[model samples]
Target chain A: MLLQAHSPRGLGSLLLMCALGLYLALVASISLGPMDISFSDSMRALLPKQSFLPSELAPHIEVIIRQVRLPRTLLAIAIGAILALCGTVMQSLFRNPLADPGIIGVSAGASLGAALSIVLFGSLAQHYPEVLLFATVPVCAFIGGALTTVLVYRLGSGPNGTSVTMMLLAGVALSALAGAGLGLLNYYADDQALRDLSLWTMGSLAGASWPGLALAYASLLVLGVLFYRHAKSLNALLLGEAEARHLGVNVQSLKRFCILLTAAGVGICVALSGMIGFVGLIVPHLGRMLCGPNHQRLLPLAALLGALLLLLADMGARTLIAPLDMPVGIVTAILGAPFFIVLLIKQRGRIS
Target chain B: MSIAIQTHQLSVSIGSKQLLKPTSVALQSGQLTVLLGPNGAGKSTLLKAMIGELRASGKVEVFGQTQKSWRSERLARHLAVLPQSSELTFPFSVREVVELGALPLSVSKLQLDDIVDKNLALTDVSHLQLRPYPMLSGGEKQRVHFARVLTQLAQAGEQAILLLDEPTSALDLAHQHNTLKLAKLQAEQGACVVAVIHDLNLAAQYADRILLLERGNLVADGSPWEVLSERRIEAVYGYPITVMPHPRADYPLLVSA
Candidate 1:
């Protein structure tokens, strides 16, 4: 008998369904904000065909939909997809279910980098603000993430190869170090810098701009294709490191490539969206549960699921308290923790 | 016959505790060599050293190239190893797990499937092809791994080196023989097959040559009839064991005296 749920055609259909749902979520997010734009009006504003209409007819509805909500919604999708994809890769890399960018200290490292930018370059940022915002935070965040990934990998790996137990423990220790560094930055920050740091740590897509949207989507596209190419190698990896080696995979190079790419992808996401928690942690499991752990299927599917989940979470953050938009990170944690608990319960006897 | 594996003064040590003493031997194709040893007798270590899975002193050459010199992917095409136990972290279907054996080979889709199918049937795991690997019993897992290594060797043609550590340890009576029989067939087909086994009877029945080890040293290496004498068995295994000629075959058979 065919494994019904795991069949490629079945999973393809599920992915198509999620893609449709994501379109619907995108429409809902654009129209459901505090603005008085109707759902039809939002849709028309989004379509290029309707862009020729009179300004009076659509009013500032164009501004509200195109300028305000569109970028934020797109950012949500891009960041969501990026986080989930990185999480899927990280989980496989560590061979542990609990590995996530945020939980494993990559996000915390990024946060520390961002915090340094706000505190150290605060005055310089005011003079040439574009340079600081585009250069300092993203570069430092990428470096921080790359360093932490290498550190964690080095700390966890032994003569027997990488130990999942050691990786998890290293993640915990690094996260703690990041937290203390963040606290120290907080102690020294000016009032405005402190606010920026807090907003970043909590994660918000409210800072979405056209350039940021372009970067996020570009990163997602590149990472998706690159990761897909490594799918078979990743499958062999699931058998065990030694077995993967016997299968002719250059395990060291594969690990290095994955770790570097993921760190860069995760660093960019964190730099743009702040430390959005749980999407990376939860989305991979959700994808694995629906499709099997086959990376070829799981990576793209996880990206779609992550995009859908983040868009929905962003929607909740926007409408949860009306005019005061809650942090999207909060929404993700609320949804993710319960799912994680169920996973833990199911895997209680098996976790090592 | 071409030599498939040659080890010169090869030895493994971890933190100054020697696991395998310096051992020199040449394993030729068309021979099923069984490594028989008691508990902690360094059989697995010696096998790992030969395969370059563990760092060892001296040299290991596969098909004239040093084990360390051949790129892993290139070496993999000519060599395959089945560790004592494979740690399957995911719930991969048995077919998927077996297909991993074809990772080093650039076979077409149909050819890979043919290879997978033939080896799966050969190991009697065709029925479990679609089952998740983690759910299989120990014997089934062992057989699946044997199939994987065999699949790897299938692509290597003749004169490939097949290193198996305890290939039949978890198998039932019939499966144990079936597994060793496959190894014997691989050797007869001109592959260099070296297997680490505990069952003296199984080794005696299947091995074209037997190498006995004790306390990190090679005690005896010869044909089953020559090396499996009562005196040698007692000295190596530290037990009173009687060796008798198999009633139906020319090989020796052992039973506790």
Candidate 2:
């Protein structure tokens, strides 16, 4: 009988705390990199027009903050938000707390797509940088993600309505098939292409650019609004699919829309950052612990919490080994895996 | 008054097995209809078919409109169903879970609050509204779902169809009686309420009409006294039961003898 009320004030306070946490992480992310720009100077660099100050950071420090760290930070925010939102949606769609983006096979499909593109165009690897990644790779990944989703969806749905169990089993099978595809690609790839593919698989913000950042934000904005609008329907779905339909939700369309939307979101995320995991899987759960599992409150909170966690993880990636960047995925797995295990231990009673 | 739901030769089959045979029936508003049958007697299947949860042959109509003609949201406002079990495992509170039922309606925040609270009270879950749903006992969880369906139908204003499957399978004696009384009350308010229940005594006590099914066929349809005859109950259920008049109540009583 905890917090028997849905008080706006309680939600307002949680949002405030999350916002504060995000701000701190953002500042640390921008200012505490290898160069270690002063907080005030970094703040000034963040300003639209930087004027000379007595204690200004180095001339190139401005470029580092404005061009490099800023875009990477914002990209982290966008990708993290998208991943978390997609994760929450996947869990809701499956009606299970444990389901994540990978459960749908879209992430695997995207990885395969990236590897394929890298191998297909490896001959021009030395000369082709921007077109290879930003254009061809992302498009291929999106197409691949879309194809695999449609395949899984078709395999699961029938006149009896879409079967969650069937979809899950199909996803597992498809993920295994995609893994085999990746293994084959690895065998065939050239050395430079292999390196690129490996880097893509690890997931990073080192390749963050303005256009990609814009694309990520656009996906986040549209996906956020769409997911939030169906918050009530998603809550109804939690009861069970049959119960959901009785509550006026077109359960079939809801599932289809959710699968495709999340696929697009995950595809974009994989395109930009490769294989960032755990943010989506863990942040919604943390949000549910803060607020109840009402998607109205859960989705936005997940987005914010996702952004903050990824920002912190990305910061660790940048600074953990000095100038040599570790994959953001590694830090997330290291951080999230243990925290998730601890959470499971605490929730063992409820889980059982 | 008027027929609220009607099905014409509705049958369901999966592969070669008929889950529900060609069965025709009609249910009216202001009546509590109880479906009685043994295990795999197709009581649940008929309910699922009427609610459009299963792929059924033949035609079903609700409030004079073909079942397929109504949009999902429109039908939801006029119909609500409680399944045998829930797959919900999220950390939602009882109140939050009940609030999910009002998703189909465009009621004001004030009205929604009023509806949710009143249903919670009606279903005897008011005391547990703040409790986390997963922590509740099985009976308590069923009561919570009962309250949710009530909340869903709160704005339906009487001309609604509410189907409940094994609604009291988990409840104790007193709560079981209370739930049936609530279903009867909904029928009194002009809603067409149908329940798939295993207890013959409860069905005789609360239902205005009784439907008996066996092997996916409608075997009997009448008032409790007409349908609860000893020969029919023994034949359909393959068990010995004595039918007798209740000492004081007007309905027939059945005791497994």
Candidate 3:
């Protein structure tokens, strides 16, 4: 028996430990980079002007910490949390351990939407206002994510309930379709739009702006509260659909709520930071291992762990090659693909 | 006794083939009911329809209230069902799984813990409370779910309705009897308890009432002695069988002849 925690106190302590770890990672993320600023120097730059600490850091260093790294770090935290939160929700909904937004075509559909927005909107860029240009991609991406989720859900569910086999196959098919759509969009995109699309495919925090950061944080807040409240319902769902309904979980509405919010969450993440893969698939599994499968504890722990994992991945993407700046998506895939393979092997029974 | 479940012409059909022909029955509190039938005999279908899981046309009322009128959460307090098998692959501890039953109830934490503890003890799974659900034997997992449903019905008091679908199909011999004994005990406490059981002797011993079905129709409804007559059993099961008084007890004992 892997006796993880014997008491609520123990679990609370474990959550605290993960939070502490996340804090350290956040500090490290803001401190260490290609510019090579000291931890204390970055912290001083972040501290208020009224603080007693003397201002000895260079203006450029302060600018680097405040303008570049701080926004980037914040973006990573929000993106990672939303990704992990959405992943946990999708896995519970599908009842498949391996379901992740990136692996299951939700991210790909959102990417397709983003591509269409760029290519179509680019042609009339001069006519449209800057605000509309900024809003179109995320709105379109959200619609795309929601539509794909509904289509996959319809294909997978029947009178008996959800067929994991059908759901996964549908995901695979949608991913391929989305890929083809992207290829077509690439053919029509202008030079600037094409460059943006290619960078998005790679996934970087290089374009982290203030407005994007606000949107990401707002989504994290909304999704975090909404998802947390339904922790009990999600747990009942794991028992089976009828079992959940028996537990008073109005199963239909719960499924709809989960599908829509998770899609929107994924849409927001994909909009803010291009497809950061595997955080959702990996974080919940780790959370369950650490805290067992109680979503009440798992959701919060997953959010913290997700933020930590992505921040760490982003840190690696920046420093490993130093100045060359590897795409964070590539770094995450390198870390995630092996873990996914191990999970696949572990689930020796029906792959569905 | 009060009627705990009453169905009026409740029927279920697939695209073309009817799985359960229209049937009506009223089950009372203070009686342990067993739905018995052979393969494709609609025993499972009747149970599914009663719980509103299957799309069946007919009026099903519980505690004098129509199924459609009672809110799901409100109904949950009064009714809980144990599925034949759960598809839960998540690594939840046994206690956590049982605790999921109390989701719809507004009981205090102490009351919730008390309910879980009592049911875990009732199902004889108190020792396995900390064990992960997936690592357990199939029977153990079933008992854990049984405990969960029991916990949900705890606060329902006299209005509780418990439905078990082949709950002992996975249990050992000792556990099979133990599970029926628990269901009987629940019936004695005034809850309406129904179980789909295949073991004829076990049903004869524990069930206060028996419902025999064949090909989507109710073939027999009465005491086990009336429902499990040797000729009736032979005709339905397509096997020659003898029904004799048990050497140790007064109820019928079935033997293949």
Candidate 4:
């Protein structure tokens, strides 16, 4: 019985731990903000508060807590989850651990799209004058992400099938093209458009709103669940194609489904948040190290860890400079780059 | 009962190079058939063609149905194959890999686990269930794959056919015997087992019938004594060899000439 438990029990416990970790992280994210609100005050603000508040409680704090931090935190969680899920799927699709949403040129494409929107549409100053810059950026970002993915898929796939190497190389080529396009757009942009484009390129959750939050979070959850159901197929695919086929998996269909789901998830994430690098690459690897490579465990665990990592990074971005805020993307890169280096160093000896 | 597999004048070419010439073979139910050939003899190609992994110019019938006539998923429910080399990129446990074999069954986890456990125990790999597949030794991985193949065979109902491409290449002597014995047991249980074997001795020891291929052509097909004679082995394998009785069994064992 103990042996059987070791074989099966560990997986269940690990899943429970990931769930608990995600829940605690969510609570922490909702509680922490620039206002230094206590857990109780945060909870009170979260719920519909009646007339029992203190007289010194500013009306703006309620608005800030409800409208700003809540939506931002929720968006952070959703975007993080989507990035991690996409990373896991992409890694499997390419059969390379280095593969990520960025490797597929989605980030560059989205960035260029956002940059073009900034240059061509005269920034958020001209369009949606009432809304902040953050809210409008996601619209252009998503369109950019989707269009780039479609282009990359078409350019990379042959009549026979999509080659992982071809996709990676195509992504690199397109990324350079998009980067050049972005540079040209930046060179020609007005001062305000340039500033907005630069900040968008840097990535910030400051633009998160209730509508954007609802769309990103809902799609992330839905797609995350769908990818979770695909865990078994992904696991079978760890074996080569012939072996996977013998195991009764429809390899081509699974590949297409995984690719599309990954594209949609990553597209939404890039649209919502500029280019949050390494979360996709690092989170899935860490999850695999902790929970083994069973995607049933890896997917959910990676999602939780990615959300927690991003939320923590966002908190650092907000609090590190006191009143001034840095881009959350910079914070993730600062943290994730070193960790990625260490991972590479550790894997250096084993990689053949 | 219907024939499990029938290949009629099957021919395969890869980039102007003929890998397998026009050949015809019929695999019947409840027999452990061995495909004997040296390296680069196109045995694997023929097996892949039968499994629809490669395009062939001839007709293939699976359980009395044309290969093209049966849907892929439906064909999967009746036939399973273990290719020559399969490397896992991820760290899936042995149990997880074996459970994948039940994918065709479309059964629940409980049912899949039951089948996986049964196959694991049958292949003597139950103890390695929780171990990562890549961490296992070469022979252990072979057994694990055998267990996976067995799980697929079990879930594939009656009239199921199995194609194996050198299933014991990485296995040691004991494991090789055990693996082939298990495949023989599967055959006795009414499944057709067609395996490509390099070791003529193992073929003579276990095969109900042997098909000899020489340079993409079927040179001979019959019982071990008829197909594995000294002259025939020398002529097909293009090597000097001697055929002698096995120490423990009456089957002919090939020795270096």
Top candidate by lDDT: 3
TM-score of each: 0.94, 0.92, 0.96, 0.89
Per-residue lDDT for A1-352 in model 1, tens only? Answer: 3443244457779899989999999888999887667777788787775446754445588877888899999999999999999999988888777778887788888777777876888856657667556767777788889889889888987866566667778888998998899889888898988887887778999889898888898999999999999998998888788888887889889999999998888888877889899999899987876777889889999999999999999999999898888999999989887877786686777665
Q: Rank the candidates by lDDT, best first.
A: 3, 2, 1, 4
True contacts kept of each: 0.51, 0.82, 0.71, 0.48
Locate the minimum summed-lDDT window of 10 residues in model 3 chain B: B130-139
Off by over 4 Å in 2: A1-9, A49-57, A103-105, A121-133, A146-177, A190-192, A340-352
Per-residue alpha-carbon lDDT of candidate 3 for residues A1-352, written as tens digits (9 for 90 to 100) = 5542234456788889988988999988999899978888899899877547667788999899989999999999989999999999999998778888888789889888877887898779999886787788888888888888898888888877678678778999998999899889888989998988886676787778899999999999999999999999999998888899999999989999999999999888877787788899999988887887788888998999999899999999999999888889998899999999999888868564
For TM-score, candidate 1 versus 2, the one ahead is 1
Q: Write the per-residue lDDT of candidate 4 for residues B86-119, one digit (tens) a residue.
A: 6675777788778777666768778777888898
- Candidate 1 ranges with C-alpha deviation above 4 Å: A1-8, A47-52, A57-59, A126-129, A157-166
Between prediction 1 and prediction 3, the one with superior lDDT is: 3
What overall lDDT goes with each candidate model? 0.85, 0.85, 0.88, 0.79
- Cα error of candidate 2 at position A145, Å: 3.3
Q: lDDT tens digits, residues A257-301, model 2?
A: 898888888888988888787787789888988888899999989
lDDT of 3 at A221: 94
Cand. 1 TM to true fold = 0.94
